[model samples]
Target: MSSPKSGGAGWLVLLALLVLVLAVASVLVGASDVSMLALLGIGGAPADPMASQLLFASRVPRTVALILSGMAMAVAGMIMQMLARNRFVEPSTAGTVESASLGVLAVALFAPELPLFGKMVVSAGFALAGSLLFLAILRRIPQRSSLIVPLVGLVLGGVISAVTTFFAHRHDMLQSLHAWSTGDFSAVLRGRYELLWIGFGLTLLAWHTAHRFTVAGMGRDFSANLGLRHGRMVALGLLIVATVTAVVVVTSGMVPFLGLIVPNLVSLMLGDNVRRAVPWVGLLGAAFVLACDIAGRLLLHPYEVPIGTVVGIVGSALFLFLLLRTRARVG
Candidate 1:
C-alpha cells in the first residue's frame, strides 16, 4: 500500500489537474452555445457576436469569481482549523460570512448610494471583527475538549445570524440579506469583481504567516518557547479569515461547506502539515466550486440554477456525513 504522504502527493496532483479541467469546462458551459471546437479554433464558425460577448462578459467573470472565492474560503478554513485547533472550524462556522452579510445589509439600508467597494470594506471589517470575537471566546473557554470549541462558535454564529435577521426584517431588508446569503455567481461582472483582489492580498498574508501559524497551533507554551507571539498569530489568522469571508460573501455570497469541505479533504489526503496542505486545499476548493458552477449552469439549461443551491445540497449532505463520521469516531 502507498504511504499516506505519497498518497497525498498523488491526490494533490490529481486535484490540480481537475481544477484546470473544470475551470476550462466552466468557461464553456453557459447559456450561449460556444462549442469547444470554436473555443479551440477547430472546425466551427464563430458564434454570434452577442453570444461571444455574453461569453466573455458574464461567463469569464463568474468563473474567475468562483476560482478566487473557492481559494479564499478554503484557505480561510485552513486558518480557522489551525487557530481554533478544531477540524470543524470554518469562516461560516465561526460567523465571519454571516457577520459580513449583516454589514452588507446595514449598508444597503442606511447607505444605499455607497459604492460596492465601500460596502465591501464595511462588510470585511465586520467579518474580521466577528472572527476575532469567536477567537476570544475560544480562548476564554477551558481547553479540555477541542470539539466543544467549534460548537461554541457555531452557537455564537447562530446568535449573530439571528440578530442580523431581526434587524433586516425590521428594516424590510430581509430580502436583500437573503439574496446575499445564498452563494450566487450569476451577478459577477468585470468591474464588480475588482474587489476580489483584496482576497488575493489576504491569501498572500496567509502565506507569509503560514509558518507562524503552524507553530502557534502547537499550543501557546510551545509557540512561546519558539519565541513566537501566539496571540498575534491567531489574530492575524482571524484577520485573513474575515477578509476572505467578506470578499466571498460580497462577490459570490455564502458558498456553504467550502471552508469546512476543502481543508478537511486536503488534510485527509495530505496530512496535517499546513505548508504542504495549503496548495491542495486551494486547488481542490477552486475545482470544486468551478465544477459546481458548471453543473448549476447545465443541469437546468435555459434556467440556470444558482451555484449556491447546488453547493448547498451537495455540501450540506457531505457536511452531515462528515459530522456523523466524526461523531462516530469520537464516540
Candidate 2:
C-alpha cells in the first residue's frame, strides 16, 4: 500500500488537475462558441475573429476571477476560523460581507463617482469593523460552545443584512443591492476583475503567516507563553479576512456560505494546522466554486444560473450536515 504522505501528495495533485480542468471548462463553456481546437490552432485557426475576442475579453477574465475569489474566500475563512477559534465562523457568517455591502451602498449613495478600488477600500474598512465587533461579542459571551459562536455571528450578519436591505429599499436601489449581494460572474471582464488579484495576494500572505495563526489558534495564554503575539496574529488574520471579503464582494458579489462551508470541510479532512491546511483549503475551495460555476452554466444552457445560487444550495446543505454531525459528536 502507498504510504500516507504519498497518498496525501497524490490527492493534492489530483485536486490541482481537477481545478485546471474546471478552469478550462469555464473558459470554453460560455455563450460564445470558442473551440479548444481553434485556440490550439488544431485546425489552422478559428474562422471567427469574435471567438478570440470573446475568449480574451470575457471568458478568460471570468475564469481568473472565479479561481481567485474561490481560493481567497476559502483561505480567508480558514484564517478567520483560526482567529475566531471557531470552525463555523467565516466572513459570511460574521457580518463581513453584509458590512462590505453596506459600505458599497454608502459609496453608491454618497459618492456615486467613486472608483471600484475606492469602494473596495471603504468596504474593507466596514468589514474590519464588523469583524472586530464580532470578536467583541464573542468575548462577552459567557458560554463559548462550539456552535454558539457561529450562531452569534449569523445573528449579527442577519441584523446587518436587514439594515442594508432597508436602506436599499428606501433608496430605490434594491435591484443594484441585490446584484451586489448575489455572486454572479457574468459581468466579470478583464478590467472589471483585476481587483480579485489583490485578494489572491492577500491569501498568499495568509499562507506565509500560517504558522503564526496556528499558534494563535491555541488559547491566547498558551500562544503568549510560547512567545507568539496572539493579538497581533488575530488582527492580521482579521485584516486579511476583511480585505479578501471586500475584494470578492466588490468584484464578484457575495458567495453566500462558501467561507463557512469550505474551511470546515478542509479542517475535517486535514485538521487545524494552518500551514498544513492552507494548500488543501485553497485547492478545494477553487475546485468547489469552479465546479459550481460550470454547473450553473450547463444546468440551464445559454442562461447561466448565478454562482451564488448554486454555491448556496451546495454550501448550505454541507453546512447543515456539519451542524448535525457536530451535534452528534458533542452529544
Candidate 3:
C-alpha cells in the first residue's frame, strides 16, 4: 500500500504541472496575438515583433502577478483560518483588504508619488490594524460558530468599506478607489507587479512557520498548553496576512472570495494540516485565478471582463455550496 504522504506528493507534482500548463495558457490567451508557436519560434517562423512586445511587456508580467498574488492570498487565507480557528475567515472578509484599500486611498491623497514599497508599508500597517480589530471582535463574541464568525467578519468589512468609500467620494478618489478594490490584471506590466514578489516572500515565510500556525489555530489555551507563544504566533500570522493583503491590493487590487474560498476548498481536500497543504493551496489558487482570467479574456472577446468579476461569480457560488454542505454535515 502506498503511504498517503507519497500519494499526496504524487498529486502535488501533478498539480504543479497542471498549474504550469495553465500559466502557459495565460501567456497565450490575451488581447494580442501571442501564441505558443511564436514563443517557441517553431516551424522557422520568426516571432512577430508585436507578439514579442505583448508577450514580454504584458502577458508575462500579468501571469506572474496572477501566480504570485494567487499563492499569496491562498496561503495567507490558510494562515488566517488557522489563526481564527474558523474555516470561513480570510483577509477580505475580515476587513483587512478594505483597510489596505483605505491605506492606498490615503497614499493617493497624501503622497500621490509614493513609491510602491512605501505604499506597501502604509497599507500593511492598516491591514494589520484591521486584522487585530477583527480578532478583538471575535474575542468579545460569546458564540464562535463557524457561520457566526464569518458573518461578523463580513459586517466589519462592510463597515470599513463604507468608510473607505465615503472618504474616497469626498476626496474625488472614488474611481481610483474602485480600481484598487477590484482585481483586474489588465494593467499589470513588468515593473508594476514587483510588489507581489514581496507578498510571495511572506507566503514562503508562512510556509516555513506552518507548524506554528497549526498550533496557533487551536485557540490560546490549547497553544499555550503546547508551550507555544500563542499571542506572538497570532501576531506573526496576522502580519503575514496583512502584508500579503497590502501587496496584492497595491499591485492588482482586491480579489474577493479568493482568500476565503481557496483555503476552505484546500482544507476539504487536505484536512487542516497547514504544513502539508500549503503548496497545494498555492498551486490551486494560481490555477483558480488563471482559469478565471482566461475565461474573463474570452467571455468578452477582445474587451476582457475583469478577473474580479469572474472569480467573484464563480467563488461565491462555490462558497454557497460549501456553506450548505457544511450545514448538512452539521445537521
Task: For candidate 2, write residues 1-331 as lDDT tens digits.
Answer: 3332333777788889999999999988976788967655666764677778899999999999999999999999888888888888889889889999999999999999999999999999999999999999999998789889888998999999999999999999999999999999999988999999898899889989899888888879999899998888888888899999999989989998888788787776766566877888888899999999999999999999999999999988988898899999999
Residue-level lDDT of model 3, residues 74-187, one tens digit each, is 999888888888888888778899999989888888998999999999999999999999999999999677888888988999999999999999998889988998899999
lDDT of 2: 0.88
TM per prediction: 0.91, 0.95, 0.95
Models, CA RMSD each: 2.4, 1.8, 1.9
Question: Which ten residues in a row are the worst by lDDT in model 1?
Answer: 38-47
After best superposition, candidate 3 residue 42: deviation in angstroms?
Answer: 6.1
lDDT of each: 0.81, 0.88, 0.88
Say which prediction, candidate 1 or candidate 2, comes out ahead on lDDT: 2
TM-score pick, better of 1 and 2: 2
Which sequence of candidate numbers ranks them by TM-score, best first? 2, 3, 1
lDDT of 1: 0.81
Kindly list the per-residue Cα lDDT of model 1 for residues 1-331, writing each as its tens digit: 3554654566667777888788778878876766655454456665356656677788788778888888888888988888878888888788787789888888888898998888888898999888888878877887546467667877988898999999988988877888898888888987788777788778767877788899998899999899999888877887788778877887778887788888887777768878877777778789988988888888988678888889889887877777888888879
Q: Looking at candidate 1, what is the lDDT of residue 288? A: 87
